[model samples]
Target: MMESQQEPKVTIPPLIPLEYSNRMMLKTILECGDDQIGLFGKTVVVGGWVKSSKEVKREPVAAALKPPTAAEAFPPSPGRKELSCVEVVQSRIPFFKKIIRVFGVSSDSYPGVREKFEPVPKPPPPPPSKFFLQISDASSISSLMVVIDSAVVPVSAGHVLPTGTCILAQGVLEKSSSHGKQTIELKVEKILHIGTVEPDTYPLSRKRLPLDSLRDYPHIRPRTTTVASITRICDTLDFAAHTFLHNHGFLHVQVPIITTIDSEGFSEKFQVTTSKKWGLGSGSDADVRHETVKAEQHIEARDKSKLGTGVKPEVKEDFFGRQSYLSVSGRLHLESYACALGNVYSFGPRFRAEKTGSIKQVAEMWVVEVEIAFSQLEDSMKCAEDCFKFLCKWILDHCPHDMKFVTKRIDKTIVHRLEYMMSISYERISYREAVDILRKVTDKTFETKLRWGVPLTAEHLSYLADDHYKRPVIIYDYPKAVKPFYVRLNDDGKTVAAFDMVVPKMGTVITGSQSEERLDMLSARMKEFDLSRDQYEWYQDLRKHGTVKHSGFRLGFDLMVLLMTTGLTDVRDVVPFPRTHGKANN
Candidate 1:
């Protein structure tokens, strides 16, 4: 029998086309799944324009190949070459060419390569694996790990990857477990540059970038870990809110932003307009000016007439041919739907025009509004508590990484705070009881503030949440005079069945009450408040036909985020670009 010797099988990584490779280079090349052998420990060629460079003084090869000018520095010329100042400066360092070759391990060894690159270098240097791998999907979960090509090092926190840059990472893939799940990670051995480069326009970096600095770059903030974590948490919470309501048989309704009624009755709204200016005159500049002057004179004459004969100016001729404003809350509209749907909720942007300078005010903000028919104030309170607790639990379970990052970096006590709130029952007290408690306090500032009819301020609400309850607390039965006219009048006739949900850090994040179902009472209450009866015809119609017992609450979504994540002093921090009183930034 003759022994036969066989040659070893040779495998090669499939060559990616220039076009396909071009797209791969534009983004961070985390993994190369095929053709592992071609990249392992081989001197591959790559070429591209220098995106960045750093001087390698210790390399004898660089010292010997130094060029006098920038033009002579790269691909050294046989003779002297003229170079510009920028080129001269760029030549002294190693340029990260667009097309480069990485002579390193295969993608299979990426995990081990990443592990080997983890230890800090001598002199407390940055990680040798200059770039960090970031893999994410639309859901913001199930990220895969791959090494960032060593050539693409992040210089600063705000440094952004160029639009297009082909990168070849020769690394080994190793299996690892994170959050109790098995996953593959790439350990890069070498980075090869390819001959393609694009301009860097997106703002991002791998440093400890400040959130304040990224305010102007909302579109790109999601690339950063902090902002990415926020986005993920926000998404999870939003889903959880809807899920909680849907599971409870609450119908989701999309409320219109532009409306004819000022639901909040605060008269703060962003009026919608189609024309550049309100069309007050028929035609011509002179005619328009004459009409404007005539309108002013009419207003003066009307005021004089009011003083003499108590006459009011007719406002029907003004803009839009009617009085209208953007909705500040969707509860009123949803209330109508609630009557039909049993339980309904509206989630959308709500506009306001209050100019107070505080951490809690914004011209435009998201609101989670719920209206329940045949429910009392206590039912609304329970619903509010359940919704908040469900949201916290859902985010914590589904977005563990994001929640961990947020709690540790943004708010140290987030999880604990939520857990404590869920376990402890919220202390329920009437507004009169709260006033009595405040009056009993030794704090002299509250000595004269034991009034039964005044509305509670943030300070008072904080005292209840922080000092009296030490958890979220619900204060109900406020004086009717201080509450909205829709609130049901209590047995005392002076108070109403309204409640405010106050948390430890965020006071009064939600305000709600049961509606007065009696048509006569509601009408009289509206008249007492001097509100227009015609303005609320639709709202009154709900009571006229078959008004049932109902209750609802309005929650400031941004304020909730602020309470859950960062203890932001200004509500603007939570929103991408908040529209404040005097400023509107895109």
Candidate 2:
């Protein structure tokens, strides 16, 4: 056997910093200094939508711009008197101090300094010098004031830069201590671009609009403060989730969105079809199948009992040579990878043929599914809890301002809820105990009555998390009748090693279980669930081969955001262009 040669390792350079060679974000400029003092005299290019603009007609006061000073130079410049006003624009700070000469001062040394100072002539007041327009780049909750000079820039401030108008400009930043508020104001020397919006038709013309009304303009909903804050929170939460998963030695695997197997066979699936009949293409076999379908268009004479035979010519014409649907979950696919990779996860959109128009239910949603090899129900719960807690902490650390704004305007107890979840461990109980607690509840009446064999409703989940435990609670060992066949059968024989993590306001945020690894036990469960054994040949092959005990869970990413953000009540509000039952226009 020949020995393999070792390849040389390549060294990668560090990433180049992007402090705006082309353009800078408002966030970078806003946080550049101690109260923005660091931005004095530094020129930058910035772009954003105009939140507010006003034409300020004020008389030019050079004294306000320049401070008075009395100091004598041994040799005063001849243009010192003429350059007094010009120096104010050049230097922000005053350069002279009043020094009284007690000793006899020489005439040559005090040539410019005299007992009585010459009065500087007041210059004529200039025309409406500039208009102040406030703009924000959606990167931060705060806005920067742009001092637009009409003579310098051709764009009309009042008409061209309305509430929803967008613009890009390059200018020098000057310190503005207006009304004792120390802030940085961009002195607009050039206007790069202007995106004007008609004031009469603009929906966000007002300073504040009702949250419900903003839902109508889904395209521009992110322009609002509430939506922008929610967006930042959601983005950070996404990164936080990825960070937690990567840190825990879980390999992220991409699962197919278009799948043949219905991982969760219990739910209705959205059928994937094409423009052609039976989803057939223009191949020779497709042509024959098309002719056969046309010939059997009317089956009134055919025996109805023969319909049980699925060997119809049209079935072969179907896409993938079998019926396929959008994946409702990635559990089965993740498990296949988990068995090989030891631990794996998949994060992507999962579609459901959901007709329910509830605030929490949507046709399409993003899910984070994880599978841990050589693990059981407890391992799944532990991983879920750690990931959940890390997400909450990440949001709190990264988006403190947004969270505060949300708390003051949306939900006041958001911070408390997150802190409570992080400070305490999630309570764990079995399905039977959860049912018992629900049965003993006397304060509130639930719409769905408590039953041992039936699935828990939103009401039951809420009661357990909010009222019973007053925190997040994990309920495990669900009844076999309620859980899917993939879940492992517990020793009790009546329940499965399945679990659900219920959050305070979000209800069930995560649900997972130890997969049935034993071939005979899995086959028995499949038989009991009335699932087709032939269709899951590959799944069964795993159990027949090197299948070890493995477990995993699925978390609704949107619901987790709602729980972390606290104020958001609907999952649609957090998701951009939410595809609900009747609302997919945008």
lDDT of 1 by residue, 1-586 (tens): 9979987665554434246343222112223334343344432222222222222222222224222342223344458676655455445323322212254435454443221212222232343334444334223323434444434543332222342233454455454323434244455455554334334453542356677777777665655666656666667777888899999999999998888877756556777654323446769989998877776776677678788776665445456667677888788889889888899999999988877787687888898999999999889999998887777677667766666667777777777877776667778888888889988877647423557788888888888889877888889999888887888998878989999988898888888999888999998998888889888999999998888999999888888777764545567667877777777756
lDDT of 2 by residue, 1-586 (tens): 9989988644322222245546777887764446455457777888888888778665655555342343331233776655454344335322221222334444447566444454464454565557788888888877888888776776555555579888888899887746535377899898888887889999999878977788788899898888888888888888888899999998889999998887876878988865243444447987878765864554433435456784344555565777788999999988888889899999999998879867886888899999999998889999999888888788888888788888898889899888878879889999999889889888889887777799999888888888878889999999998888899998989999999999887889899999999999999988887888888889999999898999999999988876557577887787787887767877
Every candidate's lDDT: 0.67, 0.80
The residue ranges of model 2 lying beyond 4 angstroms of the native Cα positions read 1-21, 33-35, 58-129, 180-182, 277-313
Assess every candidate by TM-score.
Answer: 0.66, 0.79
Evaluate residue 261 in candidate 2 and report its C-alpha lDDT on the 0 to 100 scale.
81
User: Which 10 successive residues of model 1 have the least lDDT summed?
Assistant: 23-32
